[model samples]
Target: MGPAISLLPALAIAFSASQSSAQTPAPYSPAKSGFDFPIYTNHPPGNTLPNDPVRRGATTPPLHPDETRKLIQVPPGFEVRVFASEPMVVNPVAMTWDERGRLWVLELYEYPRGAKPGEKPRDRIKILEDTDADGVADKVTVFADGFNLATGLALGNGGVYLGAAPNLYFLQDTNAPAGSGAGALQKANKQTVLLTGFGLEDRHELLNGFAWGPDGWLYMTHGVFTRSKVRDAHDPDGFGVQMDAALARFHPRTKKFEVFADGTSNPWGVDWNERGDAFVSACVIQHLFHMAPGGQYNRQGGTWANPFGYVGDLPTKGLPAVVDWRHYRAAHAGICIYQGDQFPPEWRGLVMLGNIHQNALNCDRLTPLGSTYRAEKESTLLGPAGEALRAKTGATIKQGEEWRHVGPGNFLVSGDPWFRPVSVQTGPDGALWVMDWCDRYPC
Candidate 1:
């Protein structure tokens, strides 16, 4: 693990700005007429709004798993199949793989509004397995239940780390017999509140994006608007680290917590390159950032945490966004550095991100820069490219003709407007596994 660090610098930097300068931007108000929704008007120049009328009206009823699969479009030699669907898996917001190749899915049944007082928490963690070497998940086990608004999940250190607002929990199965793989999770008998005091003002902005760093520390991200004073559970009244809209890490064995980096709005996904450099996908502002320990990035709104900390008008002034341009709505989540062998050789090492607002999965080419890296937009992996063509040419492209007009690099696209790929990962089988929220409204 890395050296013990304090958030004193981050706190000072975050709050040093004047009160007037630190005020957050006005919230988005709903539309009064038509299908126009409020957009993030605070974005810097060069950022344009998406087609709101079409996007807002694009909502279609949820398609059956088979029909939805038919609407999906992938590059030649690739196919999209149903892994798990409703009644089997619902509201899968996050996913991770264990050492034994079991997929752990975090289902947020109690979203928008968390469970009411005295009510049983509905969020759950389930383990899914394709026991017969089939593409679809045939086995599902509820590893844990009774969680309220849990958004992040990771399995390691003989237990699972869960990110539910106001607390980070660690659960272990005391009923497991000697030397069992995931049998330990088959019965979540013991629960430990590792750390406490996360914010829950915005249900969507809870503590999330749990990841393990190369140095063996468990890393997580916190969103803006929600201020957190995180302290060890055993010593809640003792010294705590103040965090807001930042990246933080914890050492499980040592029970040590540190703010790794600060300044990004609602960062829901984070991953590392082969060189151990960290990248994050955020929402509303710039969608991508190269995160480093002790670094402070430009905010979506409000003044810099530290006024004297490098001030510049350009968005790329400080620890810059990996990509300069913005995509549709810039609401990005779930990122992966492609290192799997399933994709073509040209696809290796690229950055994959889910554009929830655009209803697509996008790719970025990572090129080395001095000490950092630059992300250039690549082809749309899974999106409505065919629809774009139809709009331009006034010629309807049939379902099978979607990939014909697009480049080979555009891997997958779905005609279904509800194809919200919220999270993407390289599965154990070397294929890309996508967690489609399968909903019209991402938030």
Candidate 2:
């Protein structure tokens, strides 16, 4: 095990192998093989890397968790901690809370580079429990494994829901071995394939953003790269419906699946408010949206056709986004509406979002505007009556400028690249838990 692997507890053995264990070796190039022939090196058009560092030299190594914690800067009253990292978990993309308050995480170990032909699936689903109430995960369990780029996770239906790109599986832990270590890795007692063909045109664009909607349906998101033909088992025709770039939901008991909102590039996060209104943080264009049933939003480079293929006014009827940041400088990872009470009353109801590229945490509030809703561009913490609350982070309306993400103020910014914040979840204790993807690559 390397330095990164040392962070894992002995029981967390799935990722104990070296990072290079299953990686493919780079191909041998004749140019670098002492063949000094006349090289035609001219500038290429469009997207091309000017300085390709292929075999030039090695880059910096992974940062130590302690070192990373130093570079993080949270809002004054808030503190950030490396709940878990490295060998214990790597590439922790998205996570969900189980009925028992256990955190189930989706580990896409094979990301940036999807599984190659003939390669075995190494991705896994891990359940982290802080039994000691130390605000840190003390027990790590391998709930499941053997997946290829598994990106989404949810807990319900008497088991765990896994997003394996084209297929969705419900696995119950009834048959799980009682102990940890190698004995814990057993097939689920009951396995149900709820749906299939969710599409994997691109690895990252697979079926994701799994959330149990306030309306009781299982909601998920798929990017434009995924051209899906999804169908439930109960469908008599045995033919799945075509779906792409939309917010969709499924009913386990009814055996029904439907698309609610359309025209999203790649929505990574989805959360529901007290009134059951849904909010999402998407990738690429349309960074923030207020989704409604049958609503349509436009995606650049899309056919401009309705995601549901509706006729009449549906094609031209697209809903505007709550917040269109105008720049693609940061890759937004996850967004969560603060439903926790541990934080100040003012922090409740504000939307907390994470920007992986920018290494920042964004906060904002949404207000109803006629038929649609609009976001408060300047992030703030409001009191019970929705008045600005003053705190060390300058929450006062006059000095609240420090909490703002837009305008002359800055959001919760971090100085280190390893501070990538991919998943943000409010814990049962009402504290915010962020998942970090600390590798050098964005994916």
Candidate 3:
């Protein structure tokens, strides 16, 4: 009877095959799928959905420097000129001004994929200056080089604090002769790792958004997906704090590291309002959040790190987002509360955020709401003319099958589709300084 052959092997084979078939997803095809695929290159002129609001049409080819400037449309009495571009400063990711008013720009040349082991780092920090004060950067000096995926920079504590994943470094200019002040032009020959264990699982979600808090701590934003077990560089084997999707701070003098606030998806921007309330701009999930120390706010997804649960609650829900309304996409970066005098008086106290997917700068008015502030959509500060004008007129634009309200507009609008603004800061000259990634692929 064939030893009364057990049917176990046959049953197991059939079950495994069935499970595989169910688990494997089908390859994406535009013709077979209902989802709208992004068009990277410009479609033919006769295409019907040339500028489909949701899908977002193809990016225009790279425009000349002058032509790109011409495409930018600022409000009356304001002008958009080329501050520095290309050969002078390429792929500037983050910037911080020094005591001398020079712009220290972090050039992330090795983005998307950072430097591999044994490979020389391509990222660098350059100091751009308006020598003639003509509202243009005339001289560029290399401050430091040989950094891997450097995302943030801040000058303080007699040196520069740089956020390059897996390590936060303090760089000093050893070449500076006697008593050179902060931001002096000296070769950064001394490097010290203050803290380590920042995650690099995602290049864009590294330790970034460096800013000095009013409380004297060096603030930084650590994004979602990547888990961090930060420990002092001095204690490599000691117990470390585990965190992700959090606002972290470090004290250079004490060499202490702390996870200030928790929860958010890829928060790329952090800033404080006039009242010293901390606000953060995240991507994918909610656009803005008011973060407090030891606070566990809502994250895009995932369970909280506290196994015991927050505040003794079994199912801990996080705090709410400051912004009430939703934009077409929630990908926002670089938050700035307009404290500059270059814009009109009404612009004061308005929260300016970089709407990456929409290729514009969005403004929001903040009102005190208990401990946190409520953010209301103010206007599309910068975008395409047709879209901005339509928004101002309270019209609706066709998005897929539904027509959505165009919202409002007030500031600059660049007709160029490749005009991607990643970071916005009020310059020392009181003018708004925007860092344009200027690329077709935002990710």
Model 3 lDDT on a 0 to 1 scale: 0.68
| TM-score, cand. 2 | 0.76
- Per-residue alpha-carbon lDDT of model 1 for 261-371, expressed as tens digits? 878788877889888999988987878889988888866654444557677662545566766677656767788787777666676787777766665666777888888
lDDT of each: 0.68, 0.61, 0.68
* Alpha carbon lDDT at 42, candidate 3: 47
Give the candidate order by descending TM-score: 1, 3, 2
Per-residue lDDT of model 3, residues 4-122, tens digit only: 00000000000000111113333311111112223333467667554544345334445555555545544434555555655666676788788888878887767757666797888
Task: Please state the error at residue 435 of candidate 1 in Å.
Answer: 0.8
Candidate 3 regions off by >4 Å?
Answer: 1-57, 177-179, 308-316, 379-410
Model 2: runs farther than 4 Å from truth?
Answer: 1-47, 50-60, 176-187, 233-237, 304-317, 324-330, 379-411
RMSD of 2: 9.6
Q: Lowest-scoring 10 consecutive residues by lDDT in candidate 1?
A: 5-14
Error of 3 at 249 (Å): 0.5
Per-residue lDDT value at 220 in model 2: 86
